[model samples]
Target: MIAEYADRVWRGESDDSIVDQGMEGKGVKPIVDGVGWWSGFGNVVAFEGSGELALFDTSSPFSAAQLHADVRAWSSAPLTAAFYSHGHIDHVFGTGPFEESRRATIYAHEAVAARFERYVLTSGYNAVINQRQFQAPGLRWPVEYRHPDVTYRDSLTVRQAGVTFDLFHAKGETDDATVAYVPEHRLLLPGDLFIWVTPNCGNPQKVQRYPREWVHALHRMAALDAEIMLPSHGAPIFGRDRIRQALLETAEWLESLVTQTLDLLNAGARLDEIVHTVTPPEHLADRPYLRARYDEPEFVVRNLWRLYGGWYDGNPANLKPAPDAVLATAVADLAGGAARLADAALDALSRGDERLAGHLAEMAALAAPTDAGVHRVRAQVFSTRAANEQSLMAKGVFTWVSSESSAHANRLGAPE
Candidate 1:
């Protein structure tokens, strides 16, 4: 099943871009006069005449400086206005370049403004933790966050340069999200609402997401019958029917996950049991637009747990857990020792048992990160496992572990 999906995704049948074209420095492509779509780390929709541009979301693994450079190449159109679909750093931090523009009016939902203020207050804590979440360097809270100059509760319309852009608030992936629609152009800019990648409604590292509200947002967008759909990330989609189908299917997918998880929860099922029993609809399982390339259904279940219930997962042991390393060391000792676990992992790898090998190797690495042989075996096992993973989300995480293991091995003078 994974292979079949990979074939479809790789055949260009799906909208997935394995390599981000924008990150490769591809200049912005023109969509309309003064108006164009910049595909890089994120999608930037620009209207040049008024020297106005609205960036959807900030792209990952790229800094605000790079995004600014990409926009500069497209139009010296002075940044007139900017909008954040949500409060995520990727959508908001890149506005530094636009902030310098004296005339730029930043727009966002009222919740977004509150999120920014929270980030400012907890900048140091976020900086330390976000690094682990994204596995990127320079994880520092953006001190100079550019707050939205214009914030609305429900909806608002901004007319500039003979273009009318309507902003609607939707509490989906984030509580404060704005979906911009250009009635004249039939273009809908849904920040994270409609990324080509899997809807991150259930990010394991983040806060609660409103799945029911998210589905409503998609239904609303579908009703708009927009001709062109510009997502916060990935390529621009054309055609009203195609756009509507994608939106509706994505919403259905989220709704299914929510309903199924809720059913399991009401049955008094445990979290693990709920995750294992709940499956997304088979049709959506292969739909390119609904693929679990980033966030998985299990995480969605957890998100649902948070939404209906509080943070507690009803698991007493996990309510206030000890440090990860402390638990890992105890587990390693139960398995005899870190070396015994490493040997077991090697055996699992030799038997082509990636799942078992991954488990054992992770324990060994965590228990003894400096062990040369352990790191060597871990790098080899994880690298091969990552190559075989189909989902981009799984592949990225495994790849991060593999690269980290290889670097650790080199540092320990392990044999290549």
Candidate 2:
């Protein structure tokens, strides 16, 4: 019921404010009389109606026990319905809290079961990618998943005593994404579908997301004119007009990117051309909420190309390109040597040509992975690139690259 703590948690406010307000560490806040959101790392929204409770997203297993403890404290009412927003581990692993609820029925899209199976098969691969993505090398991908008992195809509405819970499927962050709506309360729950930040539709390491379909999904939610939107990742958005604008504007941002990418795709522009040239609608792009905090637009563009054109990128040379070392060696030989290539990368960085700098820098490192001078220059170049990036994903990747280069220097006993 405390919006202040939720706001404080998001605004990076005082730790005492949270503790003083009785929210030890969990960021749970009641949206209305009975509706509540437990915003730990990911959100688990709760709705109390029909003399029972409906929870949206159970959160990761890491915090599931705590969530159960808190939700129980909030109301000992049995969980009538537990909605799995999508197949993401963070959203699904917490189902243990409701495992014993005889009245609670798990529900999700049909694709969620398949996603769980895939996660089980590629748990190791998922762990590595997740570590790189989050910069947490120790993060483990979970094999345990709570499969949904009730699955829907397009849409489903369940009537519980006096309230109706409408569930609509959309392909945005994941193929098995769902957005829950409460018509009576004029509230909407978009599971990572409409996070306050830019839509996470451009995940570089994970499966492909539907950018255009994401736009449609937002439009659908906007049409509801839902006064409140409880997103999975960030704080809740209140007000009908503000909610509509956030949803529509998010859709508009995606539409602009998709249109620009498709235009280039139709004109036979290679992925390289599209990635560098596609411009974001600066009017909307500069917004604090739309700022590239997580997935940036360039990755989204690359995803678009992949969706329409596959891996080929309409470039014959990239179809079955030479090995990285071979290509780097060939380029280094042409530029006189690896040292010359690193010098050129530094020059590109100086010229504010980060794209060129990154390309040439990677080539420089691959060409002479053992050379101290090359590693030093590559480290400096990538460090600069990381500093310039606004998105967390981009920064993590560039910072990791710089760290790798620095590691090479450490191994060689190079001077600091």
lDDT of all predictions, in order shown?
Answer: 0.75, 0.81
lDDT of 1: 0.75
**Location of the lowest summed lDDT over 10 successive residues in candidate 2:** 14-23
Report the lDDT of model 1 for residue 216: 94
Task: Please provide, for model 1 over 1-416, each residue's C-alpha lDDT reduced to its tens digit, 9 standing for 90 to 100.
Answer: 32243244434464543224422355566665666666654566666665555555555435678777877887676666777788777667676666675557778888987787887888887775566455665766775566788899999998865578899999888899999998888888887787765677776656678888998999998999998777777666777877888899988888888889888889887787887788888876666566676677877888888788767766888989987677778988999888898899989988999989998898898898789888988888888887886565566667778888888989899976
lDDT of model 1 at position 366: 88
Candidate closest to the true structure, highest lDDT = 2
Report the C-alpha lDDT of model 2 over 1-416, residue by residue, as the tens digit: 35564445344452221012224356456778787778666778887776787788888877888888888888767777788889887787665766575646888999999999999999999998878767877888888777898999899998752567799899988899988898888989988886667778787888888999999999998999897788777766677877787788888888999999999999989898999899778888545457667888999999998888888876788789999999999999999999899999999999999889889988988998898888888899989988998777787778887888899988987777
Each prediction's total of clashing residue pairs, residues at least 3 apart in sequence or on different chains, is: 3, 1
RMSD of each: 4.8, 3.6
Residue 348, candidate 2: Cα error in Å is 2.6
Q: What is the lDDT of candidate 2?
A: 0.81
Model 1 regions more than 4 Å off:
1-19, 22-24, 49-78, 93-101, 122-135, 138-141, 311-334, 350-353, 365-371, 403-416
TM-score of predicted model 1?
0.83
